[model samples]
Target: MHQTRLRITRILCMIMITALMVPLFSGCASKGNSDADKGQTAQPDTQQQEEKVEEKDPVTLKFPIWSTITEDLFTKLDLVNEYKKDHPNVTIELELLKDTEYENTLKIRNAANELPDIMPLKSAWLVNFKDNILPLDDLEAAKNNLFAADFKVNDQILGVPESQFNEFIWYHKSVFQEYGIEIPKTWEEFVNAAKKIKDGGKYIPIAMGGKDAWPDYPFNEFMPSLVAGDGDYWSAMATKDEPFAKGQPFYDAYVKIKELYDAKVMGPDPLGVGFDQSKLMFGSKQAAMIALGQWFGSDLKSMTDVDINDIGAFLLPVRDSADEPFNTVSMVDTFYTIPKTSKHPDEAKEFLNWFFSNAWYPKYMSEAGLQSTIKDVKIDLGTMFNGAFDVSNLKYVLNKGGNEDYKKIESTIKFDVKKMGQDMMAGKDFDKMMQDMNNSWKNARSKLK
Candidate 1:
C-alpha cells in the first residue's frame, strides 16, 4: 500500500511540472509573434520613406510678360498649360502688364535684385540686363538655334532668339496689276513707279505714317545700312568726323527720301497720318505700298479682308542696278531669358527644354507666324516673301547694335530723328537739317570720346 501511494505522488508531480512548462512556452511563442509583427510593420515604414524620397517636389515659376494677353501672350500661355499636363507638380504664374509699364517695372525689379523667373528681352535690352541674366550657353535648346551663337555678351550667351524678321516694302499685287506697273528692281525704277501711281490719281504711292515718328525707321534708321551694303554702317559711323556729309551713305540715303517727299508721292499730307491710318489706307486700296517688317503680316491680315494672295513683298531696292547685291535688314526680334534671381531656375530651364523640343518648336513658330530660328526648321512666311527673296541667299544686315554711349547722347541732345522725318515731309530744307544733325552728332561724339 505505501509503494502505491509514492507512485501516485510522483505522477502528480509530473502533471504540475508539465502545466508550469506550458505557460512558459506559451509566453515565448507570444513574444516571438509580437517581434514578427513589428518586423512586418517596420518593412512598410521603410518602403514609405524610400517612396517619399523618390517623389518630386512641387515647383512654381513666375513669368512676367509685356504683350497683349490675346496676342503673343496667348501662345505662350497655351504652351505653359500644355507643359502642365505632363508635369502636374509644376505651375507657372504669368504676370501681364502694358509694354511701357512692364519695362519700367522690370527695371525697378532688376535694381532691387528681384526679377521674375522667365521674361522676354529685346536684343538691345539684353546688354543692359545681362549681369542679372543666367547664361544659357549650355542649354540644348540654345545650342540648336542659328542666331543664338551670334548673340553673346562677354562670351556668354545670356539669351536665345525665338524668331527673326526681315524688313521689306509690302505692296498690293492687285494695285500693281491695275496700274500696269512691273515690280521695281532699282531705286530709280521704284521712284518712277511712285510718280506714275501719283499721276494716276487713284491711290497714294506710299503710305507714310509720319505722325508716329517711329514709322520712319525703314527710311531713317535702316536705309543707310541698305545703301552702304554694310550691316555695321551705324557702328562704323560712330568713328566718323562727318557722317552726314554730301557723299556719305547717311546723306545719300536721306537725299533719296527727300526726293520722295518733294515729289509728293507719299500722300496728300503724309505727316498728318499715323501707322494705323497708313495701314487703313493700304488695306482699303487707297495706298499702293507700306514699308514694314514681317510682323505687319499678322496686323494686315487682321485689319483687311484682302486675300493673302493679293499681298506681295520686295526688297527695298537701294542698289542702282538689278545685278548689284541688295541688302535686307534682318533682326533677331524676341529673346527668351532667365533671371538670376529666379526662385525656380531649374524648373524654368526644364520648361525651356520642353518648349524648344521637336514636339513644340515647329508648332510655336508656325502658330506665331514667325521665322524659325531653329536649324532645319523652315517656315513659309507666305508666297509673297518666299518668292521675293531667297532667305538662304539674301545678304542680311542686322539691326544696329545698342550703344549706351549713343543712348546717353540721344537723351542729352533730345534730337528726334522721327521728327526730322516729319519735317522733311513738311518741306524742311535737307541741307539745313544735315548741317544741324552734323553739329549735334559732333557734340555727341566728343562726349563719347
Candidate 2:
C-alpha cells in the first residue's frame, strides 16, 4: 500500500511538470499556435473581402416606348420589375407616349440630344436615328438575333428586333357566316364584301380607329408596299422624282384605299373613334371586323366581353386578282436600341443581355404570343393563326422605312402618310392630294445633298 501511494504521487508530479513545460518548447507549441492563429484570423479577413465583392452600385435605366404602359411589351413581360430580381440595384423606368406621337416625340427629343436611355424604334425608323444611336454589333443580343443582321445600317447593326410577325384583318367569323360572306381574296372582293356588309347595315362593316391616325397603318402605311410587292418601296421611291404620280404603286394604293373609303363602309364616324374605342366596337360585336397585327391578339384577350374563339384572321388582300401574287407584310418590329446619351449604358446593356438570355427571351416570346426573332429560337404562335396562309402565290413585303435620302426628303416635306390616311377618312380629293404630295416630294428630293 505504501509503495503504490508513492508511485501515484510520482506519476502525478511528472504529468504536472510536463503540462507546465509545454510553453517552454518554442519549436512545437509556437509552431502549432502560429498555424491556429492564422486559421482563426484569416477567415474574418477573407469574409470582409467577400462582402466587399458582393456589393454593387445601384442603377436606373430610362426606357421610353409608344404603347401605353398597359399594352407595352415590356409591361407584358414585367420587364422593369422582373429585371430587378437578380439585379436588385437596377431599375427600368418606362415612359409611355401615344403611338401617334411616339416617333415625333422621339424626333423632337432627339434634336436636343435628349432621347431616352433605351428606345424601342420601328425597323423603318432605325435609320432616321442612326447617328444618335450606338452601334450594337458587339452585343450578344444583336449577335443572336435573326432579324438584327437583316436590318443593319451601313453593315453595322444598330438595333435588335425582338419579334417578327404577319399582320391580319381580325374579323368576327360568326358575323361573316351570318352575312353569307366568305373571306375576301382580292382588293375588289374585299371592297365588294365590305359593301355587302354595309347593305345589310346591322353592324359596322369595318371598325376604323382613324382618329389616332396611326391606326390606319394597314391601309395608309403598308398598302403601297403591298401594291409594289416590295418591302423597301420607300427606298426605291427615293430615286424617282414623281413616285406618287398616277400608275405608281403609292398612287394606285391610295386610289384603292380612297375607293374603299368612298363606299361608306368604314363605319359612320371612323375618324371620331380612337384605337381603344375601335377595339371595343369590334369586341362588342357592333363592328364586323378590324384590321390589326397578331400583337392585337393579346389586347383582344384582355376584352372580357369578347369570345376569343369567334375571332379569326386573314391576310388583307391588296391584289386586284386572286391570280396575282398576294403581298403580305412580314414586319420584324420593336428594335431595341440604346441611345448614345444613356448615362447607364453598361447597365442598359447588361439588362438587354439578361433580357435576351435563354432564361428570359423564350418565356417572354411565348407570353407576347409573338414569333421569336432570336436565331434558332422558334416560338409557337397561338391558334388564331390557323388558316391565315390559305392563299396562293404569297409574297412577303419587308418594310425598311426608307434609305437615307428618303428619310431626309420625308422630314423636309413633313410627308406623314399616316396623317394622310386620317385625311382620306375625312373626305379629301384623292387626285389633288396625290398631285400635291408628288410636287412636295420632288421639291424635297432636288434639295438633298
Candidate 3:
C-alpha cells in the first residue's frame, strides 16, 4: 500500500511541471515573434528615406546676357567650368544677344512665355517685369545685396544688383589745365567750362554720342533724378497731367539740358557721331571730356593706345548752386533675376547664391573694376577718383524703379528721355517737344487700367 501512494504523488508533481513549462515556452515564442515583426515593419521606412536622399535630377539652366564675353567678367572667370566642378549634373548655357535688341528681345520672349532661366534687368524695367519674375526676397543672395531691398516692388525683391556705380564726367587732366578750367560745381560753370574748351578750338569740348541715344543718359535720363534728389522723379512725374509744364522739375531739368545742347560745345556735328566714334575720339585726345558712368573706367582701362594716367573723373554737377545739395546718380546695375517660368527654379537659385558667394563675387568685383554691392565687401576706387567725390553737400540719388502706374504711363506715352536727347541734339524745338510730351502724358494717364 505505501509504494502505490508514493507513485501517485510523483505523478501529480510531473503534471504541475509540464503545465508551467508549456506557458513559459509559449511566452518566449510570442516575444520573439513580436520583435521580428517590429524590425521587419521599420526596415523599409529607413530604406525609403535613404533612397529619397539619393535621388537627384540632372538640370540645365539657360542664362542669356546682353554683354559680350569681353564685357562680361564671368566669361573670364571660367564660370561654367568652375560651376561644373562641384555640380557635374548641372549645366549653364549662356547666350549672347545684341545689347541694343536685348530689351525688345526679352519682351518678345516674355510674351511667348519662353524667357530664359536667368536674365539681367535695369532698375527701370523692374516694374514692367515684376509679375513675371519670382521675388527673391527669400534668397540669401538678395539678403546679402545692399541695394536689392531698396528696389523692391510691392515689398518683394525681384532682382539683386551685382554692382553699384556713380555717373562721372571723365576728362583729360592736361586738357583742363591747358584751357584753365576747373571741375564745374554748378550747371552754369559746367556749360561755361565746355564753352571755353570749344572756344580754344584745340579739341572737342565734350564727346556727345547723340546717335545711340543711350549714351546721353548722364544728362537726359539722370539729370531729373539728380534734380529730384532720388529715383522717384519719373514716378512722381507720372502723377501729374502736365509734369513737363513750365516751372515744373522736369521742365527745369530739360531746360538746363537744352541750354547745354544749344551751346554747340560738343563739336560741330554731335548728332552725326555715334558712341563708338565719340569714345574713340575721347580716347585719342581729340575730345577733352565724355559724360559716362563709372563703368567707362573699365572700358578706358581696356584701351591699349590711350595713356590712362591722364584720365580723371568727377561727378556731374546738376545743382543750381554750390550751396544746394550736390545730387549725383548712384546706379545699381546688372540686376540678376530668375523668371517664374524657369524649368529649374531651385537650381537657378542655387547658382545665384553661389555666384554671389565669397568664391566668385570678390574676384568679379576686382576684375570688373566695379564697386561691391554685397555686404561685407569693399572696393577701392583707386587714384582716378581721388578728390572727385569731395563735396560737403554730396547726396546719392538711388535709382529705385518706377511704380506700376508709372510704367503704364511711360509705356502709353512712349516717352524716351534718351531719344529726347537725340532730338535736342538734332535741333528740335524744345518747348514744342515738352508740350507734346505733356499732352501725351495727360492722354496716357486718363487711360490706365
What order do candidates take by TM-score, descending?
2, 3, 1
Q: In angstroms, how far off is 427's CA in candidate 3? A: 1.2
lDDT for every model?
A: 0.79, 0.87, 0.88
Residue 351 of model 3: what lDDT?
A: 92
Instruction: Provide C-alpha RMSD values for all models, in order.
Output: 6.7, 4.1, 6.7
Which candidate gets the maximum TM-score versus the true structure? 2
Return the TM-score for each candidate structure: 0.81, 0.88, 0.86
lDDT of 3 by residue, 1-449 (tens): 89999999899999999998999999999999999999998999899986765565678899888876334666778888789887777888988889899889999999999999887888888887888999999999999899899888888999989899999999999999998888899999999999999889999999988878899989999888887776788789877899899988888898999999999999888888999999999999999999998888878877887888899999999888999999988889989999999999999999999999997888877777778999989987777888899976999988766788888887877888899999999989988999899889999998873
Kindly report which residue pairs in candidate 3 clash with one another. Answer: none
Q: What are the runs in model 2 whose C-alpha is more than 4 Å off?
A: 1-42, 69-77, 111-113
Better of 2 and 3 by lDDT: 3
Q: Which residue pairs show collisions in model 2? A: none
After superposing candidate 3, which stretches have Cα over 4 Å from the reference? 1-57, 69-72
Largest lDDT belongs to which candidate? 3
lDDT of prediction 2: 0.87
Better of 1 and 3 by lDDT: 3
lDDT tens per residue, model 2, 1-449:
99999999999999999988876786688899999999999999999897775677777788877766335656667777788888888888888888768989998998887888788998878888888899999999998887798888998999998788888998899988998988899999999888988999798999998888888998999999999988889989999999988899998999999999889898999999998899999999999989988788878877799998999899999998878999999989899999999888888888888888887888877777788888888887777778888999988888677888988888899989999998888998888888898899899999984
Model 2 poorest ten-residue lDDT run: 67-76
